[model samples]
Target: MSTAVHTMNATALKGRARDLGRRVTVLMLLPSTLWFLLLLVTPLLIILVFSFGERSAVGGYAGGLTLANYLNLGSRAAAFSNTLLLAPMGTLVCLLAAYPLAYFLAVKVQRSRSLLLTLVIVPFWTSFLIRTYAWIFILSGKGLPAMLASLGLENVRLINTPSAVLIGIVYGYLPLMVFPIYVSLEKLDKRLLEASQDLGASAFEGFRRITLPLSAPGVITGVMLVFILLMGEFLIPAILGGGKVFFVGNALVDLFLQSRNWPFGSAVAMALVAIMLVVIGLYLKLVARHGGRPGEGAL
Candidate 1:
């Protein structure tokens, strides 16, 4: 009877401890939960509400239920098309450029890996706006164009073009793409490659069969990261495209700040959010179909 009572008491104490732990966890999460609610969820809810409203005569939301704002999305079709086209294109370009660098960092460089990695991210130490502004100068008529002109390529217009925007996107987002793929490749089991080699597979064949499949998660992550940001990209296009190229983000800025079309802006934002969700869902489904996990990379 005494032993049974002791065991019961210990069980009760364990239950109380678990309860206390849960309470502590809840307490610890409370601030972040509140912050998420106040900052993210609240704004999203407000945007959703405002998306259904009307634009006031002067400006801003007029607080009425209407689908006119959504219906008017067709007007910005060009911006949407530009964003859709350039975002993917930029992501692909970044991927093509980043993969070899990532592979080199992960596989080839052994001693100065840290230094090289530092070099890769050194640009990030400066302000992003400043970096982008520098690109404006670099691509200007007096910059790369001038150099190219001196090299016999006369009248080369690099600035204020889609190519300039793409260059900016690749330059700005390359590190983001590289790091994920690098981490994936870095953590990969090298033994698999060696085994494939022993089994008479060529380097390319080994990469195709083993390395590529394993590194797929990182590729997906990098692609998603670059693509999503590119979709909402404004500053690069604004600075480099010189009012020639327009994206959904640029349109949003114009609506909110320039035109003060709050309702329409909200509608556009909501639509962007919906589109992102659909794209992400489709991407995840595609990855899953191909036996790839999107969240497999270390970083």
Candidate 2:
């Protein structure tokens, strides 16, 4: 009877302990939950509500139930098209440029790796706006064009052009692309490559079969990061293209700030959100097919 009583007491104590733990967890999560609701969820809800309304005669949202805002998305089709095209193109370019550099930092450099890595990110120490502004001078007629003219390639117009926007995109977002891939490659198991070599696989073959597959998660992450930001990009195009190139972000700015067309801006913002969700869904499916998770290796 004594032994049974002791076991029962211990079990009851354990149940109480679990209940206490659950309460503690809930308490810890309360602030963050409230913060998320207050900042992110609330604003998104407001935007969704406003998206269904109409623009007032003077400019802001006029509450009503209508689909006219969405129906009028055709007016800004050019901005959507430009954003869609450049975002992916810029991501691909950044990927192509970042991979080899990441590989070098991860695989080749040993003693000075930290220094080189710091050098890669050194540009981030300065203000982003300042850095972007510097490009204006560099690509202007008195900058690269002047140097090129000296070399017999005169009349090279880079500023206020799509090429200038692409260059700015690559320069600005390269670090975001590089760090993810570098981390992925850095953590890779080098012994796998040696084993493949011992098993009579050539370097390229080993890379194709082993290294590429393992590093896929990083590539996907980098692509997604760059692509998503590029989709909403405004400053680079605005500064580099000199307002000649328009993106969805630029359009949003114009609507909300300049035009004060709050309802239409809200509708556009909601559409952009939807498109991002679809793109992210497709990316997730691709990751699933390859049997890898973001920020984790296939192995």
Candidate 3:
């Protein structure tokens, strides 16, 4: 009887505590909940309704529903192709460049890490648009080509080419690429690396086996962040590619702004959202399958 009484009292105490905790949590969450509902949720609901409606001849939404918009999805296949291709390429390039820089920053410049990091972020203080514009002068005929021409090179057009676009993508997204990998490598244990070397492993081998795997979470985050944003990229391609290299963002832009086809625009927007979902799903699957940590999947 005494044991049962104690058990009951313990259970009741836990229940009361949980109730109090719930009240506290609700009080804490109320502001954020209301903010999201007002800003995000409501806007999303409006967009969903707009997607189903027709394009007004003048340029906006009209009250009607039809599958014609979705049927036109195939029209932007080239744009989709460019996005799927360039996004991966851009992300891979960023990763290739960023990993070494991150490794150097994390392992080499211990005393100057904060200063170097500040330098990396200094560019971000300015608008990304302004920075991309700086590249224009650099790649223009009078900047790079001019120097090359003085050295007896033939005609060179770097300002409006695919290579220029790639360079722009690399420059714009570098800081984003740097920070995550830096954080991961900075937090990594140095002793494991020494242990590998002590076990007769080369510096390269130790890094390949240990440093890379340990920083896999950061790698995944940096790649995903770059890739997802790349998929929706417009300004870089437009400014650099000279309208030759179209992307989904360009297609959406043309549909909405130039053609005044809101229905088709909505369909394209929906398709973009769908593609993002698929990419995110595949990314999660890959992370889970590759023995990455739980926190990595969340990233």
Candidate 4:
């Protein structure tokens, strides 16, 4: 009787497992399916439709296909130039800044790692807009400049400068930049380091051969994330640059809100999307090229 009961239980478990797996598959897909349809797919279709159309006299998308809107794309060359130049630079700066923090948090300081990580993430608790406002004051003439002047530096113009914009970008995105690298570093096999050192590799050499290679995925992810958002960043340039540094984001804002040229704006928006795609593709290619090791899997 006991043997029969055990066998029946095994059969029941198998049946339940199959049912659970089906339910799990549906559960995993539900959120993403909804997100794609509502957020991504819908907006993309709207942008696509707008890209092929013309603008109305009163300013908005008009129902007619035209190539003129796309032809006028060259007018915003400076915006494109600024975005292309700054986006990568900002991402690089964030990486350089974040890597050290993440490294220290992951490798060096073993105590209170949770506390330290919380510190890194705490800034993200606030809205980015609110944080940018705080930067406004900090970069203002009365903020850092005032402090500097007391120390015999007569004049400093941090506010409304490219440097200010860079600072804002780094500050705002540092948390984003840190977390990925930290996860990669924290998940790294400690035994690999031990093995490298055990085999007579020096500290720096061990890091170079082991730690750096393993963390490439995080590096790639952070770079991709920060670079993409920086491309469409208008608020940073608008506030920190004070209208001097024109980005494609700013152009889009003006074309839509100020100029009321919806079709042309849509074209520019589409062009911006294309540029972002190309940049991201190039970034991924670079990552794939350098990120892969002969024996290791690509993350």
Candidate 5:
């Protein structure tokens, strides 16, 4: 009877400990949860509400619901077109440039790997705005254009063009694309490659069958990261394109700050967020179909 009582007491103690642990976990998460509610969720809710409302005669949101703001999205069709086209193009460029460098770093470089990685990251330590501003001078008539002109290529205008924006995009986002793929390649098993070779597989065959599939997760991650950021990019296009190549981000800025069309801006912002969510969802489903987990690296 005494032993039974002792066992019951121990069980009660264990239950209390579990309760305490649950309370501690709730406490730990409380601040972040409150912050999210106070900042992100609240702001998004406000934006969503404002999106359906009317704009004041002078500016800002006016009460009462209407779809006029959404309908007016057609006015910014050019911005949408530019963003959709250039963002993907920029992502592709970054991928093309980044993959080879990442591969070399991961698969070929035997010494000073850390140093090389540091070199890739060192540029990030400087301000992005500063770096982009420098590109303005670098692409000016006196810069690369002049050097090329002296080499017999005439009238090569790079600054304030789509090409200049692409150059800036690739330079800025290459590191993001590089690191994920590098991690995937670095973690790959060499034994698999050796075994494939032993089975009479050529290098290309081995890469196509084994390496590519395994590295897909990282590739997708890099593409997603670069694509998402490019979708919202404004600075490079603003500085390099000289307002000629406008994106959705540029449109948003113009609406909010320049035009002071708060309701219309909110509608645009909400639409942008919705589009992003849809894209993310579709990409996730595609990755699921391929059985690829982002950042998992090569097995």
Candidate 6:
């Protein structure tokens, strides 16, 4: 009888300890969970709710649900078109420029890798707005235009153009693209490359068969990061584009700050989020399809 009682007490103590551990785990996660809820989830919910509401006469959100805000997306068609075209193109240009730099740093440079990598990332130390503003002068009539004009080129205009905006996009996002691909390449198994070479594979063939396949994860990550940010880009366009070439980010800024159309801005914000979600979903599906079994192409 005493033994049975002792066993029951021991079991109860163990169960209580398990419950205490579970409580501690929840407590540890509570701060971040609450932070995400308050800052991210709550704002998103508010935006979604506001999207369905109407704009007040005084230029704020008004009560009552309606699809009028979404229905009015056509009003900003040019913004959408500009963003959709340039963001992807910008991302592509960044990728093309970054990949080779990343490869040279990761696979070629041994002694100066750290120095070269630092040089690549040094631009980020400056304020993004400052860097963008600098470009305005660099591309202005007293800058590249002036230099070109001296070479018998008259009336050269680079600032306030789509080309200048592309240059800004490429410069600003190149670091983000380079680091990911560099990390991917750095982690890649050199044994695979050596074996391919041993089997008489040329450098190009080896890269195509091994290097490119293994580096795909980095490429995808860089693309997603750059593309998503570019979708919401305004500063570069504002400075370099001089408000001539507008993007969705510029549109959102004008709607919220200039026009003070809260409901319309919310609707545009929701659409941007939805489009990004759809794109990321499609990307995941494509990754899954070409994932080609475990331990295959993955770095």
The candidate maximizing TM-score is 2
- The lDDT, on a scale of 0 to 1, for candidate 3 is 0.85
221 Cα displacement, candidate 4 (Å):
1.5
- Per-candidate local distance difference test: 0.91, 0.91, 0.85, 0.87, 0.89, 0.90
- Range of the 10 consecutive residues with the lowest summed lDDT in candidate 6: 290-299
Q: Which residue ranges in model 5 land beyond 4 Å of their true spot?
A: 1-18, 291-299
Per-residue lDDT of model 1, residues 1-299, tens digit only? 99999999999999999999999999999999999999999999999999999888999888999999999999999888888889989999999999999999999999999999999999999998899999988999889999999999998898999999999999999999999999999998888889889889899888887878788878988999999999889999999999999999999999999999999999999999899889889988877886644323212
Tens-place lDDT digits, model 3, residues 138-203: 999889999999999969889877788888899999889989999999998898878778888898
Q: Give the TM-score of candidate 2.
A: 0.92
**Clash pairs, model 5 backbone:** none
How many clashes in each candidate? Answer: 0, 0, 0, 0, 0, 0
Model 1 — TM-score against the truth? 0.91
What's each prediction's TM-score? 0.91, 0.92, 0.90, 0.85, 0.89, 0.89
Model 5: per-residue Cα lDDT at residue 285: 90
Question: In model 3, what lDDT does residue 194 have?
Answer: 83
Off by over 4 Å in 4: 1-31, 150-153, 294-299
True-vs-predicted CA distance for residue 31, candidate 1, Å: 1.6
lDDT of 4 at 173: 89
lDDT of 6 by residue, 1-299 (tens): 99999999999999999999999999999999999999999999999999999878988887788999999999999888888888889999999999999999999889998899999989999999999999988999899999999999999889998899999999999999999899989998889889888889898988877888888888888988998899999999999999899999999999899888999999999998898888779977988797653336422
Residue 166 in model 1: shift from native, Å?
0.6
lDDT-best of 1 and 4:
1
RMSD of each: 3.1, 2.3, 3.3, 4.8, 2.8, 3.2
